[model samples]
Target: MKTLPSQLTPFVRSDAVGALLAETLGHPDAEFTLSALGRLTGVSGPVVHREVTRLVDAAVLQDRMEGRNRLVRANPEHPLYAPMREIIAATYGPVPVLRAAFDGVDGAEHVYIYGSWAARRGGEAGPFPNDVDVLVVGDVPRRTLSAIAGEASDQLAVPVNITRASREDWDAAEPPPFLRTVRSRPFVDVMTGAVHGG
Candidate 1:
């Protein structure tokens, strides 16, 4: 892993770091090395190593050595992973709700509710859960996506982000608004780059 230079920002031990890493692991197939992990967490290599080791010991992350590289992944069953990913995505920018907000009719393709609050907010607030972050991307219509975003917000009973863009936007832009914003943060850049035409 490259030793992060002083010019880089520090990763704070907060929802952003946790959520970004959590979301990165949303797919079991997601893989990365220490340098990648450092960028994802918005932390230096040493900080990431310490946090990852702690998570591994706590059973929140499972670690493997891929040659000289150390790989880390979230334990899928961890109660916090899903919500955390959504929250991290949401914190950086708006995510489309299941509704197609992008369409004139308020229809949407898929919406992922994420973050700590995405895990623990249920009307009766006993605990001060984190914000309800989200990621929305799919074939759903714009209007419909917008309309449903309100309902989804009410259902989650928390701040909901909507990431909605035209297919053309996602296919052509090197860093769509969402991806660029996600990468522009001081502490986290969960998405390293945009998939041109996936």
Candidate 2:
């Protein structure tokens, strides 16, 4: 499976690092303390602290001591600020947002994001992705999936296209041509289970 940039580099390998970068650097209007960041990222406080220190040293983030608590925010003045934000948005932003959108929806065995955005995130060079293609595997209702997709689209600020497949179809020894083709491409597993081709 083709992996994300964060998985390929020591500098951005940690989940906390990617989460912190995407949430703070990608959304400059937000600020967070270490504990809050840990909670948001589902990472431990010490891990968040280490990543924050690294980002602070790299000038990607700025930290201020607010009495006993330290608050962190993106460093807009940094030379790499804009580029870094774009990178984080492209690489780390979608999965988490999409995963959250699917959290309340029942009956989905797996959710995988494929096509353009996934391709780009997998290191294929291309124009900036304008749409997100999602493949939903299981017995989920089309209406429910569409609603979730609509919600995710609004939350992610990008158009979301959904494709549905039954678990039997997805897990077949030889999937149909379309499913085979989609599985052959790079994709990100939004839910926990391992995606067939990812």
lDDT of 2 by residue, 57-138 (tens): 9888999998999999999999978877777766567776777778867788888988877665455667767889999998
What ranges in model 1 sit over 4 Å off? 1-13, 77-198
In model 2, the Cα lDDT at residue 21 comes to: 82
Each model's Cα RMSD: 10.7, 6.0
Model 2 whole-model lDDT (C-alpha atoms): 0.74
lDDT of 2 at 118: 67
Instruction: List lDDT for all candidates, in order.
Output: 0.46, 0.74
lDDT string, candidate 1, 22-137, tens digits: 43454456766768765534456676677677777867677799889988776777887676555443332222222223334333333444344333211122344434454554
lDDT of 2 at 46: 73
TM-score of 2: 0.63
